[model samples]
Target: MPQLQEPKLIAGNANMPLANAIARRMSMHRGKQVGLVDARVERFNDGEIFVEVFENVRGEDMFILQSTSNPANDNLMELLIMADALRRSSAARVTAVLPYFGYARQDRRTKARTPITAKLVANMLVGTGIERVLTMDLHAAQIQGFFDIPVDNLYASPIFALDIQTTFKKRMDELAIVSPDVGGVARARELAKRINSPLAIVDKRREKPGEIAEMTVIGNVKDKTCLIVDDICDTAGTLCKAAEVLIENGAKEVHSYITHGVLSGPAVERVTNSVMKSLVVTDSIAPTDAVKKAKNIRIVPTAPVFAQAILNIWSGTSVSSLFEADTLSPIYDGTYAAE
Candidate 1:
């Protein structure tokens, strides 16, 4: 068999800092210098998206790093158009690396006349020349089935577990891992297992999309430091309310580890005013100005993870091993040992 071509990385406007960080990590892995493909993605006066590639990509494996975060439509469109351009340019393979996949909450219809927008977005991606997808902590795992091509869904548990181990070193015996709601108990349990902490659940009744009717703590949390885990934190209404309820239930302190910080609307204000000691989120979605200024909100880098995944995919290796507990030691020290 012929040797596999070196992977080419292109980024959209959603999160350039993260894309650049991933590029840097990939460069370190390759030893010799590697950089993002020289490309221009911009808009015309009428708001039409335009893409131009400066270098040849013929027969090269291509990966587009774009997160469909806030202003979801524009970023999503940019990914599709970029993939189409690469396909026309005769690239061998095109994989979309979406750090934060928007419209994921609309994976299914909750009522009449509502569309499964997540599936629609998946169709749109496949309709473009995208051959595969690599994303982190999708809101719903079933979204993977929406695409005909291969989809690799990575988890943030390893990163969060390592951070928790470092932050609460002497307080492990006093820690209680919490799920913000029943739907997230599995995610919370995974982290609890990794850290050998007890598990708790926040039983909440959602009156509507952004409102909560009642909430109760499920397990023992008295005098214990509680850590809530979830996939997304939009508006932060539910997260803040859960923190309040946990405090009222006699928890010592409340913190959170969320995969995607889609902190839109009044999320920053609510988090600031809430009882949470701190809210930790991944760099899946780029932070806003307000988020940057918030004292209690911290961001964990996912670039190393994505960079390793891209390299593994291009080399036909196992992506799941990236999350194995034993193999993640390098992540804690800001280094990755490439295989």
Candidate 2:
């Protein structure tokens, strides 16, 4: 790998903690001091977004870290404006690093007059002059195709598998990984295979956004510890209902592992009162104060993965190597045993 100019990291108001953690990992990996580029992202009294890049970015590889979470529209606008500002400032390349891509659930339309907002968001980013995109665990993998530019969609399965092994240890064989809906069966099945656990699916139908009809457990879960896996946990309606039904069907205990925790509305309340034993989520989107205060919630840092990916992209190396669920190498100090 050849050395290009040092890449510049810029974070939006979306997830500063994850961005800072990523920067720390990058500095450690490079064996050199690395820090975020100075930038200001703010809003006016009328709630208009503003973005300003303090340092010169001319010919520098710029990575803008932003997750369109709670205030999806606001954070999204911030990212777009930042990318536009970077291009106008003469950046060599602008990579939008979206750990949790919002509007992804609406990748397609089921009705005649619905909008494909995910594609719209992609078009907006590309039109704003973003050269590339780096996101993780999109609600739909096909969303990557929506962008004309190169898109890297990272996975959180390896991270969850490592933590599951560490947490359950000898009890993994007594576990069953479940998908809350048929759509997530592939993700759950992959994790189940990694841990050698039985796979189950919660057959569910969505009545409307943020709501689910009665769900049925597809596989045997009687007396087995159940682990429901999915990409996003928003509103908690589906997860809470799935956990309740899984327990009603005789599961010993219900645990959840998800990539993005967009715990909106009464999500925390629902999880706290639900039958789920615990909910583990990655720090793709920053956790709210309520999420941190919840007793049944755990957070796993995802910085090492993103940091390594960014480094690989900057060095023109193979990013696919990071996807393997083997022992994480020198990059992560073998801290993450992917299996």
Candidate 3:
């Protein structure tokens, strides 16, 4: 087989720190220093986005690391425009590496006249010449079908499981993994299975968006240390509320392992005052100043995972193997050795 071209990683303003970290980790995996491609992504006075790749990427394998987080429209536009530029510049392939895929919650129409914005976003990316997509813990799994190109949805369960084991090693028998709502039971179950712990579900009735009416714990969490698992913690209304209910339902302590921390609005304030022992989220979205300073909020770096996945994709190896139980332990333990 012919040798693959060295990957060219670029980034927009969505999450530069994560992009940089991924580059550094990938460098370690390759036994050399690999840096990001110098690219300019800016806006005009009238708010028009502009993109210019300073380095030559002709016939190169390109990956644009961008998260469609807060200021979603602007960040998404940056990714689209950047992809367009790379395509026009004759890049052999362009993969969109979205740490946090925005508009993913709108995967389906709940009411009449509602639009599936997730599909729309997928269309937009494909239209912009994105050949593949790499995202983490999509709000809905079906969102992957929206793209005609290859979509690799990475899971955070492995990372969370390792952290949970290390943090609660002595109390493993007392742990109970929880899903904040019915829709997330699968996600919670996966983590529970990974940790060999019992599973619980928070059955909540939604009054409306960002509002919870009532919540009930489906399984016995009495005196157990509960760990709530969810995809996105937007506004944190559901997450904080779930923790409160878990504590009230006799859980000894409540913590959360969320994939994307789209902690918008009063999320930080709510989490700060909530009954949760801690809220652990991945570094998919760049943490705001408030998030960074929040006492109980912790961020787990995903650079190692992403770097390994990218390497696997480039080398025709199996990306899914990275999450296999046998292989997951070393990936986050700082070893990051390939299987």
Candidate 4:
């Protein structure tokens, strides 16, 4: 077992709900072991971030929890500065545990003179002296290659599967799993295989960046309940459009399962007007005002899953087993496996 004995967990201002949830799963409160001095993140006269970890972290295995979500640049700087602070404090190893790796979708260029922001983010983390990256459900698997150090890309599909199995147990016979677009076909296929249900795909044609035309459904969905699965839902364009198509194709009911709910700019309104029965999202990105007020939106916590992975990693066990969707009864059942 790796036994990161005396491992230290620190958190920043971003996504405190998720940080506290993970800490609870670890059976500890935040800042119980060491001095978590007041973090004063304020801008200077010219607008530059300043941070200092008031506690000693010398020779400790430190994990800093911060999500680069809304206010992406500020949160990102906080993570970078936290890592730098730990490194300067002589920590043995510093790991940036980002539940949501922002800008991950910009892994490649769609046009000339474009920047791969994902790689740039990785370079920034490397420059901050971070030794490892622990994140969940990246937009692209190859983003792991963007980092020079060990990057553990975790999946939330298994956790979601448990939820769906219980929620729709009675309707399993008439259920259908759907991918919002061609890019998410693999992810949707994996989830479908786990639930032992049929898979479907929506092929969308984009006349431009903002305008998406949902072309057709590649699988049978008539008289069946549809579950559209995707890694993230940013503008809610693809998800909403696909659900509309499914309903138009005689789908009895439509539901969505998206990992990261980066619901920005009128997303809640779009979902409210869409045909989806409900939108299930994780705590990857903190919910906004509209998302919280939206009647059809539901939140599924990923704390237990991330905590278990951390425990497994600390105990020197294989996290690969977490990928299989069959053993995920705890998520929807409201009970968890501690073994």
Clashes of each: 0, 0, 0, 0
Q: Tell me the tens digit of each residue's lDDT in model 3 across 164-268.
A: 877888889999999888899899999999889999999989789766788888999999999999988888888888888888889999999999988989999
RMSD of each: 2.3, 1.5, 2.1, 2.9
Q: Model 4: per-residue lDDT, tens digit, 1-339?
A: 445456567888788788877777665422344333335555689878887776777888787888999889989998998888888889888888899999998999999999999999999999999998889999999999999998888888887777787788777889899998889999999889877899998898999887985479998999999999998888897889899899999899999999999988878899999989999999988888789889999988887667666655556576676676544454324542222
- For all predicted structures, in order, the TM-scores are 0.97, 0.96, 0.97, 0.92
**Candidate 1: misplaced stretches above 4 Å?**
332-339
Q: Which segments of candidate 4 are over 4 A away from where they belong?
A: 1-4, 28-40, 325-339
Better by lDDT, candidate 4 or 3: 3
Q: Residue 274 error for model 1, in Å?
A: 1.3
Model 1's number of clashes is 0
Which residue pairs come into collision in candidate 1? none
RMSD of 2: 1.5
Give the winner by TM-score: 3 or 4.
3
Best-to-worst ranking by lDDT: 1, 2, 3, 4
Tell how far residue 111 is off in model 3, in angstroms.
0.6
TM-score of 2: 0.96
Please give the RMSD of candidate 4 to the true structure: 2.9
Q: Give the TM-score of candidate 4.
A: 0.92
